[model samples]
Target: MNHVAPPGWPEQVRPPDAPEWERTAVGWLLDQCPPEYRGHTVLRRHPVALARLTAWHVEACQAGARRGLAEARTALRDALPMDAVEATIAALLTEQARLEGVRRAAGLVEVALRGRRFPARLPGLGSRHE
Candidate 1:
């Protein structure tokens, strides 16, 4: 049977019921994480574990982005041109948005890895797991 992933699912990952979906999920999760995470054999072998780690990593990245946005002006204005400082702030804002999306996608993948399936729900029906 065909399956449909819910909104916020990463496009790089196949639906949870697809063939070798776990492998794709693992690959996508690892891509979100730092290179050192690839060295963990257990995480490579376990999709759920990798998903959890990816979630944590994404959370840390989001926090870093927030801190950078908060300090961008005060920290860089003195050392850099005003234009450069503004660019830095803009970059941080963009990163914050990107990280938020990644965070949601990672959470969805983690839920799928835990045996929760997101079939296509009816219009106006909201979300359901099976």
Candidate 2:
């Protein structure tokens, strides 16, 4: 049977049942991490480890976006025009939204790597990874 991807699965990752799915997962996860992460053989060899690392990296990025959103107005009040500060705030909000999706996708991959399976018709199930 073909694999059924859970909600919030990353488009770049093949379904778990696909041949070499782990390799695809590793590639997608590594893309989410720093360039140095690719140098670590352990992460490439272990999908779960790479998933964990990717999740952590995405979380850090989300936190940074949150901090930037919180301080943008005040931090830029003197140095930038009000419109520019508002634009910065908008940009930070957009980044936060994007990071949220990345976090969800990474979490789903991580759980899948850990042997969690999702049924095809999980009605009313939220996208939150277990």
Candidate 3:
């Protein structure tokens, strides 16, 4: 029998909409740090950067908010201590908040449709991830 690629293969492993789906250590960093810093270049190149990012991830997770790990992970972006993704794919793929950021991200996707440097952060979108 021939085997055809199934739909939702990767998503089945980790659905996108399942809040906290991408809230792991690195995921958290990707969500918080600037989009420019989301590449392997930083984590792969700089040991200090990787360590710092990892440390922050742990800190965000271990703070203890009564919410279950899954819940906390999901809401990691809702009230994160750090800033969230400013990129469109990153935002849409990650389901970001902040109307302005969303608008900017959408605009970015329109222009680049997959380009670099799309805000990654705005001025007024603050204090949500606390």
Tens digit per residue, CA lDDT, model 1, 1-130: 7576887788888888888878889999999999999899999888888899899999999999999988888988889999999998898899989999999999999998898977678865653332
2-75: candidate 3 lDDT, tens digit per residue: 11112212221122223432233234334444466666775634434543654454344333222232354455
Ranking by TM-score: 1, 2, 3
lDDT of 2 by residue, 55-101 (tens): 88999999999899888888899999999999899999988998999
TM-score of 2: 0.89
Better of 1 and 3 by lDDT: 1
Compute the lDDT of residue 92 as modeled in candidate 2: 91
Clashing pairs in 1: none
lDDT of 3 at 28: 37
lDDT (Cα atoms) of all candidates against the true structure: 0.86, 0.85, 0.35
- Deviating ranges (above 4 Å) for candidate 1: 122-130
Give residue 16's error in model 1 in angstroms.
Answer: 0.7
lDDT of 1: 0.86
